[model samples]
Target: MNNNLQLYNTLSRSKEKFEPLNPPNVGMYVCGPTVYGDAHLGHARPAITFDIVFRYLMHLDYKVRYVRNITDVGHLENDADEGEDKIAKKARLEELEPMEVVKHFTDRYHKNMDQLNVLHPSIEPTASGHIIEQIELIKSILDNGYAYESEGSVYFDVKKYSNDYDYGKLSGRKLDDLLENTRTLTGQQEKKNSYDFALWKKTDPKHLMHWPSPWSEGYPGWHLECSAMGAKYLGETFDIHGGGMDLLFPHHESEIAQSNACRGHDPVHYWMHNNMITIDGQKMGKSLNNFITLDEFFSGKHKALDKAYSPMTIRFFILQAHYRSTVDFSNEALHAAEKGMQKLFNTVELIDKLTPSSNSSVDVQHFKDSLYAAMDDDFNTPIAIAQLFELSKIVNQVNDGKETLTASDILFIQNLYSVFVFEILGLISENIKGNDDQLVDQLMGAILSLRQDAKQNKDWATADKIRDELGKINIKVKDTKEGAVWNIE
Candidate 1:
């Protein structure tokens, strides 16, 4: 199972061989959401993308420690390093404690992820939970002189770290490039350099979520918690770090810079980022005011939605595109995914009930090779799905008796469909849900009970009336195998 798996690492900007720091064991960390609002459609891209990576790695027999963090305390809504916590702002508006806002949104985020069927990570460390670790990291950076105190706050000296490590390695920009256009936002002038970010910020007296720290009565800075908690739990360096493409610049880059500044080593081995979800070529961001929450999509409450889409349909839509390619949301594209997924699930169900023959028509090896190649080439699920459809054609033809499959071929398809569709891809067809003949049984029972009363009155016409009514609901009642069994057409 240890075939050379190729993944497009954002750190190197190429498809490189995925070599975990510890062979057969990988440590992965993704920057989870700053839970202040409901998670939108923009949230599912990176989530399902990494879920596929986790599943496929385990499928290849690797034990992965996937750590995704919760940013309960975050920077300002305007992306200002010195602004008030986003969660804190919500608490003030609702007149509740800051922790209350975190509790509500955190619960909502979990509920949303549950709907997507995204597997829970091995460790979900909260920023507030690891305050000591973050403070310890800032202390180490202070001792190393990579960070300096200003009043009660501490800022990382980005200019100093740039001397050794490339500051914009992940973003593909250099110091001069960022320094030129990195607009001078308010409140960041307190840092040593324009690019320097806060490692610890002194909280105001009115700030609702202040904690005692070495610097002051303050919480960890926006980017410091990831480096500290990651280093504390995973190690100085781990196998993979993943998130949305938006995090490449200041968030992830700052995390790497702060970690290296304190620990004197690079942090992650592989950097994976999933592309954004666009409404109409524009990024569906909060500022754009075009984002749709998962609940809206599920409930069909959005103005653009014709009807509610199931969770599996949304997951399928995201998977249909390459992880790095931006997918446009539209009724047509979504409908296509819905039709395509239903066809796939239906074909999977057909495999078990297919009657094997003495001969076979389809080449199972070719389908297997094609599906594996698509997945091995960075988990290309859309193309894998196309291959599934190709197999589906053969399965349906066999069902129609226009084609044939040998016993061995049938078993191969059964295992392939079960593994790829159910186990790995996590789709289930509605065909497996209830008793197969229950619908017809219920319909015919009512009709036949009425017919018995008609016969008791010696009324042939009334008995015939009940039989005709059963025909409308596709109930076909037949007397066979010791008693009458009914089926729906």
Candidate 2:
């Protein structure tokens, strides 16, 4: 509901103040994983990017209904209209049901998102579950003379639709250039033009997934699902549509065309896209055989990674850069992020223990305003994070007795960190835990007390056995003048 909030709209190619169609109500649709394989670094960027948008809008008191669709079907192997469906191909290769493949990968995808602290969408509709809706959308397009059926398949009249409406406004592609450069591929003979895309594709004998449709026994096209599901869940037009920049060309552009063809108008008010995560100056993707999966990063199982990085580190690394900027992956960058995250957490802890004074040494309102200004200007998380770092320096000064804060200022600082760091940025402290870790620490203290008793009684054998047993499990016990302390090695 904040009128000052601005977002970079890919359609307009500029930052614009976000105004929802309805007051205090926002509808956002983001393109989600295809679930044909393990989620990779490429998948994490957009998820985290939109998670920021989702969190900030809700923080602004907007009743946000975020719809992120799961593409369980109709996403082809080559991202084209003719190739095998990605999930179906995985199923065929693994000798399992297509839905089973979808469930397996989708579960892993969800687990990874949860580890990254990404919030779940309000509604997650699947393409397979919404087959009927896609069929009806195709029917509407055909009725409106924007699509045609050929040899039991339906193709969107892209060349024809371009004449009536702007075809590539989202992607900025020209129809004549597309037609001239678009190479002829297999299974395109039925189309009137080479650039025309499918609304529905006729299933071949070997095609593993299909449903009965009016045109033929087929499945929805790759671009048809988002158009159908976005309109179904968020009305004919919604506030924001988001995805990775790589999808801007064919996937999202076709989505715009499909929506316009059927609904006779634009579907989304704002189009937003997050840039890619690159490795060795190349975009990370599964097809390139150079991408690393989230599992590999967490476990340090990939050859490219120097060591294991926590989920928060990965999330921090992505957020350290603007959502629209390409983030190149490197171990040094991740290590820096890990250190930066720990410093922020340490500052929060220090702020909690700070004693208040009768007078404040700093203007806490300036800090708040700076943070808000960064977010309002296109969700600039890096700048907001910089402000947090500056606040960390101030907190260090107060803790060291070089500065002071009033009781009200201290309370304000606490609430500010809680709202921005935990709620909006979705960062959780790795070293800090809830009651579970407290209980573990207490139990460990009792065990250490028993070892101390053994040492006091001069039972060298028992003390050595206890210490050795603990060592076998990767716990190192250090004895100093203060006392014996144990840590996980």
Candidate 2 lDDT over residue span 2-81, tens digit each:
46899999998999999999978999999999888999999999999999999999999999999999988845566544
Assess each prediction's global lDDT (C-alpha) against the native. 0.82, 0.90
Q: What lDDT score goes with residue 244 in model 2?
A: 93
Give the lDDT of residue 55 in candidate 1.
Answer: 82
Model 1 ranges off by over 4 Å = 79-82, 430-432, 435-489
Q: lDDT at 201 for candidate 1?
A: 83
Q: Estimate the TM-score for candidate 2.
A: 0.91
Shift in Å, residue 39, candidate 2: 0.6
Predicted candidate 1 versus true structure: per-residue lDDT over 1-489, tens digit per residue: 376678898888889888887778888888888888889999888888888988888888899888888888866667534557778877888988888888888899899888888889899999999888888888989999888998788988888888888888888878887677767665566776777788888887656777888878887788888898788778999988999999888889998898888777789988999999999889987767899899999998999898788788899999899989999999889889888888887677668878998878767768888878888887888888888888999998998889989999999988888878876776655442336567755666776777778767989798666666666765555543334444443
